[model samples]
Target: MNHTLLRLIIPGVFLTLATGCVTSTVDEMVFDEPSEGIGDATVVILGRRHASDYETEPDFIECVGKHIAARDKSIEVIGELEFLNALYPWFEPRTAPLKPSDIDKLMLQRPVAQKLTALKTEYLIWIDGSTVRNDSAGSMACGIGPGGGGCFGFGTWSNDADYEATIWDFTDRAEVGRVNTKATGQSYMPAVVIPIPIIAPVQGTACDGIGEQLLQFLSGHY
Candidate 1:
């Protein structure tokens, strides 16, 4: 067995396992093979601003950062806090929302680009989207109209979470790829007393799916 055979066999095992977990779609928007490639560069994962509160879940952000870091040893992964610090007022979600064009302009600025260059931020991953309650059926009832009232009924609801992770190559100054993740789950609330929790697996699924695909891209595996 040669080095090439080992490389092929080992990574294939990981990829197989990764693909089995979630449904991931990768779209390569503009890919021009870089001369130096993604060798040991810094990768920043960021959550985009949204009006909805659930869009910026800390758990989801951390999940992605941790998984991406774990996937590749050579590359440096920057967490949400550090990345936000680097962007400062411009990327703040509380204020006006920013479009890709706005970011493109900022990157074109010499000072901004120089600052990011100093950080060795070769790739920028913009993560957005949320999991939300889709529909509800049945209902738990409680009423008191000047008289003692106690009501009970079983209720059920479902949640759907969809997310997208877009990759931008800072060195190339262009959008390179994107990963889309969608997951839906159901849960039931028994009576008006006991609450059953059915956690939607979207964030975990997105983290795993996006992280694996990104690892493959940066490591030149897929």
Candidate 2:
């Protein structure tokens, strides 16, 4: 009700309506000559889960795939789970190829080759990394009284997302390129009488960056 309280509450209210800040960068490298077009072949995006500390989120992988497919109708994308289940033990974490060269060995198995052929899979993209909350500070307090119950205080946190996509050309049996994306953002929770959260889309930014880069890379425009 006082001028000082009004000043604090007004700023906090405005912040709640605003999204947190986010910064993202995408870098790509093409080792081999990219194909001019994909025609009817399919591209499969899979998340890497071999790390002991954290696994690449499945939703993130799906997000990138959908981004690509939505932007370019010519590109066909196969879902990560569908491709993994179709391949079975061959693409499992324990037995999956660790590098592009390793795919050569897998193709030696008749069944592996047959399945890939049946799917018309041309490009296999392996995405690895995760988004983690790095730092956080501040606090909130709440109390209930006869007058009313409310919460007050402020809090903020930072998030970083780093991911890399390794592109393998199944048709050529070689690695074509690599795309790396990094994004950082800060989220805030400002409370006056209620808590309003302003969340930063760190991982989503990373997905969009990598998806665009991959789209260009596959289209031979990168």
Candidate 3:
């Protein structure tokens, strides 16, 4: 990215850590610039899963996709449905998520390569991980009655999320970049007549951090 801005940011990022150990660590690595491919490049964001039943949160995917599309106006961002439809047979009746090895195999095949290239898909971004409730203190219990459900409690909990985005360059049949984001923050949820929602904003954090980093890497800024 902007080396000057990066230099300035490094100090601030480090300083923020001194105040609290619960923080986010975002690491980014870019191998080579894909300048020639950006103009007509289409990217599909996939969630890498170990189990067939597992699913990635749609909101998180949408957030990251939206940010990437906004930053790179020329790049076409494909949603999950479009991606699945385009790769129909590859996913057929039953199968587990495509591991990195599987992706490599598919990319190296002539037919697969030709199909994706025809569709103008230059990169595939695979995201893995989730946000979870780490710890909770106090209680928030609700019950339904004739008057409806109501509960009372004063409680706090921590949300910790870790996600990694791996960018595979279909043109080169190799991974060109990766971004890892770890975020942890406290959340507050209270119930008077209804529970007050306290969002940790982990997904948003990961999206913004990874999205910007991905854009910079793609544009040769990093």
Candidate 4:
């Protein structure tokens, strides 16, 4: 092929295979029902890390929080680190409540209760789960010789993200609701002279899905 034709074809191929397909679903269940209005109450998103195998990603938690705050200007979201720091040792990995019931025990302490009141923490959302590579196939080989080098072959993999957000009403000291999100997608890497990656935004899709649902749940719109 001539240089001009080759250049045009390469760009077209890249454009066609630049992105992968992603599917996402979100569900919400309310137990105690949301308050009529959020008012000045503060919402905090925290990641659960007590599990032995996997801990929720902090960035994912932050992403959900940002999504909620951006979609609803009236709702306030406190940063995970800021909330943990403000509460100090009480919120540390060893002491943080593992379940909604545990919050009852933690709140029994006068200092903890006072601090939570000071922060105006009305709702606590605990997110748990991770994105994992489910399956992978194919491979690419690359080598360099005296003349030149190039990579050849194709690769593909699938990732699944499963996350659950449990919302707790701090003021009422009860479990208010839950939001669950699942996203799955396949990624492809095709190598001609170099590897071109078409990545699926599985985790990002999950984050966005849960964030929107949480916003509606908290706002009592659902």
Tens-digit per-residue lDDT, 10-122, candidate 2: 89887656789899988889887456867788999999999999999999999999999888888889999999999998999999888878888998999989999999999
| Candidate 1: Cα lDDT at 133 | 73
Q: Is candidate 2 or candidate 3 better by lDDT?
A: 2
Model 2, which residues run further than 4 Å from truth?
A: 1-17, 33-35, 144-148, 220-222
Please write out the lDDT profile of model 4 over residues 107-151, one tens digit for every residue.
888998898988888999999999999789998999999999999
- Once superposed on the true structure, which residue ranges of model 3 sit more than 4 Å away at CA? 1-22, 35-37, 51-55, 91-111, 141-150, 220-222
Every model's Cα RMSD, please?
A: 10.6, 5.8, 9.4, 4.5
TM-score for all models, in order of appearance: 0.67, 0.88, 0.74, 0.87
Cα displacement (Å) at residue 203, model 4: 0.4
Tell me the tens digit of each residue's lDDT in model 1 across 1-222.
Answer: 699999999987755543312233444343544444477678888887675566657678788778866766677888778777766755677642244445567766687767777888888788887767768888777666676665577766676667777887775566777777766666555655444434445456666776776666676544
- The model with the greater lDDT, 3 or 4, is 4
Q: What is the TM-score ranking, best to worst? A: 2, 4, 3, 1
**Best-fitting candidate, measured by lDDT?**
2
TM-score of candidate 3 on Cα atoms, chains taken together: 0.74
For candidate 2, the TM-score is 0.88
lDDT of 2: 0.90
Model 2 residue 174 CA deviation in Å: 1.2
Query: What lDDT, from 0 to 1, does candidate 1 have?
Result: 0.67
Scanning candidate 4 in windows of ten residues, the lowest lDDT window is 213-222
**Which of the numbered candidates is closest to the native, going by highest TM-score?**
2
Model 3: per-residue Cα lDDT over 13-130, one tens digit each: 7555423224677998878657654776688887765545445566787788888888777778898667777787674325423544566667656876677878788778888877
